[model samples]
Target: MHDTGDAETTVILDNGGHNIKLGVVGAEGPRLIPNSIVKAKHEKKRVFVGHEQADCSEKFSLFYVRPIERGYVVNWDTQEQIWEKSFSKFDIEPTTSRIAYTDNNYLIPALPDVSNEIFFDKFGFQEVHKASASGFVADHAYKIRRERCACVVDSGFSWTTIACFVDGVLIQESVIRIDVGGKALTNKLKDWISYRQLNVSEETHVINECKEDVCFVAMDFEKSMIEAKKRFDENMIEKRYIMPDFQTSFRGQVKGIREPLASDAPSIVLGVERFAIPEILFNPSDIDIDQCGVAEAVVESITQSPEDLRAALSENIIVIGGSSCFPGYRDRLLQDVRSMLPAEFDVKVSENVANPETHAWQCAEKLLEYPAQVAWINRKEWDERGDSLEYSRFFRTTVTSDELKATTQEFEQKGEKSPKNGEEEEF
Candidate 1:
């Protein structure tokens, strides 16, 4: 590959399960494109990737082959196609630019090797740097003056992960994963709707939209349930969601709470399901998943950190991801966490209020502003070292959970104050 020298730009790709957030560093922001390579029944001969899926005139019977599964890129063939389309569509030259790719925090061991091979061997990129998505968010939070130490609750499509970062370095052992996410919530909503009102199991896309438009985390679960049972005309809890007729409207939209009109098409009344669907994040037992909820997971993760940093982690909690975009999610999470902690701990849960969908990507863009040459491995270096190259060298800034704990213990034994606060605190 030809080197573009210093003129070559940096590219940031937050490859998410639902959407691919791609943009050049120093650009305004990342552009979100559907990550699925789809084949529609109407046009079986053609395959669509990225924004190409939008051109499909027929909206019904669309089949999607998502490259990402359970927060990992499982299918490189489809992923490569999506990447190629994104590069071409965005006028980006992959071969000449430096690439920073965001992978899931609990990345599978083999995937990184595959990613390196693809970017270095097949795509012929000048350089590649891989980092956890949460790391970028932590760096972004620190850069934006949120806090140096933060607990990130990334509730994405496949899984909800709680990870702690001190000074932008991830605490490996403090990471917690809950298998509940937006996709599971969407599927639960579909199952409930199919069992009660209509069979929407086949209409995953429309049901997902309904969940996004109407679903919320209820602050008062029992009260919400009581309110859901009341008549729609008398109760404020019930709302009607009119399903779209794909022939005319390409996508379904929420029409708000209203009296049923004589000419109104097929519609479903969404009652407690609106809040209950998202409540699964807090109570996984609702779906038979024997795991702690997002808030509990956060507390659990923070507890695994050094004792002195727990208060700071609680105060600087950063909630991001598509699932976190739900109304009252942050408030509910704050309430839950606050109730579990002591009164002295200042609990502050903050979301990326400006742009929830591109939070990680925005963080990545900010991270690119710094000189991260040491974090990157060029094609020449990888080719020379081959299998002998230490992959851990790329993430030299990160610290394992055990390392963090051990260092903190040593400091405590030495009677020295924590790194952030040199002065010791009275118990």
Candidate 2:
């Protein structure tokens, strides 16, 4: 690792599809901001950015225009607007300050170009460093667990990906991704709710909140389904979700299993959908997504690594991102991975559910200590080399645009709306 020695302000951003995590390298933690520009139907002609109207408790249809789609930046104009709104808080001197960005591996061969044009040409930033959403997880693990080899299972908004690293360097060949994540689960929950209860097709924002407040992963799929069928007081898996009136509350609440509610209050009786929703991560085929489940992908990723590092990677599987925050996610994933691996291989899965989505931001903040290793592109360097990326310093993966395109098509075909980055991070 090489240090630049110059103390330029490096803004660390863990840009996810649902939220953007922003902070300075030395700050205690990242500040999370909603990543979309929302246009509420009631507030006609007025647009809100960075959650300006997010807390406006009212009944309205939210039409969002996000810059990112399927873990990549597709509409740079909208992205620029969001970034402009977010950048106001940082007191940054673009000519001198630096940017540390992470996204879906930046393997598209064109992301760096677009990013440079924006940060350098438009935003006037002096330097920019980019990495994958999972680029720094290996290094972060090594720092805490002293584990030089790790397999990172990042289950975020756009999708879940499994990547293996040996000695903190990515094994490009050992990368596998499945199109199952928070957004998928949220939409699934919304569909189930609409089918069994009320229609919430336009209430995406509320439905998402409904999911966060009530959903959980099932440790045993069969047992949980059986438990979900039990009567209210007798059911251990059942819960009452009280929907916000928008007049008093902005988000829904998950009450006790037998909690009483006002007769007029809007509520949903959550049952098998809670566990069944998250189960898609373990069996994407359940949603008709033609990809292996998260655990299967993890095993596939590790088995593709060098034979010697497989054991080390197995013992250091670190799971992060938004979807991984679900209750019972770690235990279920650990059990599934252990069951699929060879009998002699010992499997260990680690999770920090408190704030799993911030792990990438934390790791990116640590990468600031080694500017040379990260390959910061200053203005002068950008002028000389144009917008081309140095693939050698950048992380590369076998996951392709075709795979991503297929994933996008599958979701859209199923009537699932696209969400911004993760637990996919960004610029």
Candidate 3:
């Protein structure tokens, strides 16, 4: 704790592709801010950065200038602006405070160089640590359950990743990334709603709100499909989502199918889509995405790890990230994962019931509590170790882009050998 910096002064920034969790280490909770500059259709000339978009009106649609793409910071300028505002909450000058943040598992090789340029040169931060999101989940698991081996299924905004951790250390070779996540789910919901009821293709923010409000993973996809096809009076899964008009309402809300509605009010009727939208995460091929689902990826990651840790990994599986917040996510994931594993092996899947995005930040705080684990690079080390500086000293750095391409191809090849008819009996 002493080596990292003062807990009261240290800043925790869990910079996810969709939302950035920011707060001082001692704060009760982190401020979840959108990680994109928003362009409100009503205010074309004015762009809202981070949480400022909450004030503007999305009359037609809202466009975003996202700093991070595919989980890596691609535009540092946009990121710096968001960071500038987020850091301003703690101090005008972060030159003295330490920072801890999370990144994607399979990161861009050169992303760290540009990130360091921003950390040291642009912002003048004293010390910083970049760890994979799942690594912190592993850290938390080790501390709470004392489970040395665990598999982390992190389905975030951009990518859904499954990685194995043995003794709180990530086995880099066991990391598997899926192309489906919150963004993909949102897009699918948008497409479905556009095709079925309303044209909400341009209404990304509104559609995302609609998705979160009503979407839930179906435990039995076939059963849910049966319910979805039933009459409105007999269908229990049918929901009526009232779209926001921005007068008295802010965002959309899910209402019961029998609920009252005005004649002129705009609304979308959600049927099987409530479960089908989230189905992509379990079976990406449901929407033509070649990647395997979360449960399959989790099994693949654990099986590839050392044989001794596979059982332990199965027993202590943790799913963290935005997509994991869905209502039936845990139950559905546990069912699928258990089905794939041997009947004798114990299987359990869990997520932060309160908030999935903040799990990593909480773990980061706990990780910093033990001084022995603080591997921050201060200005002195950044200056002295010009050529010898190793980014992997703090966390595992992913392979280069070319190597990453090869790994993706390998994933596609392995995806062909999916679990016992994962999505074979689709609706």
Using TM-score as the measure, the top candidate is 1
lDDT of 1 by residue, 1-427 (tens): 2232452788998988898899998888888899897777778899888889778776555677888778877788888889888988999886788888886533444555467777877777888777778878776666555466789888999888888987777776688889988889989998999999988877777888899989899998998898888874667777788777766566666655775444456788888899999999999999999999988899898898878677778888888889998999999999999999878888988644466678888777766766353367777777888545535544534455556665566556866432333331110
lDDT order of candidates, top first: 1, 3, 2
Q: Residue pairs in steric clash, candidate 2? A: 17-420, 17-421
Which residue segments of model 1 deviate by more than 4 Å? Answer: 1-7, 110-112, 143-146, 260-264, 371-374, 386-390, 396-402, 405-427
Clashes of each: 0, 2, 1
Model 3, range 1-427, lDDT digits (tens) per residue?
3265442367777889999888876667688888999887778889888878667865458887998777677888899899887677545367877777675523444445466667778888878776777887786666554565668888899888888875566776678889888998999888888998899999998888888999999999999999899986898999999989888787787788998886556998999899999988999999998888888998898887655556667877877899898998989889998999988778877534356767777777766655446677777777787425545466653332233344335445665221111221100
Query: lDDT per prediction?
Result: 0.78, 0.73, 0.76
lDDT of 2 by residue, 1-427 (tens): 3344354778876778778888877777788888888888877767888757555447457887877767767777888888887888556566667888775535456553476678889888767777776767776555444555678888888778888875566777787877677877878887888899988778888888777777888889998888878874688777778888777676788887666675577788888888898899999999899899988999999888765557667877888888888788899988999999988887887644246888888777766655566666667766777644445445544343333344345545765221111242222
Give per-residue lDDT, candidate 1, residue 212: 93
TM-score of 3: 0.88
Error of 1 at 247 (Å): 4.5
Q: Which is the leading candidate under lDDT?
A: 1
Mark the regions of model 3 whose C-alpha exceeds 4 Å error after superposition: 1-8, 90-92, 105-113, 351-353, 370-372, 386-388, 396-427
RMSD in Å for model 1 = 4.6
lDDT of 1 at 208: 85
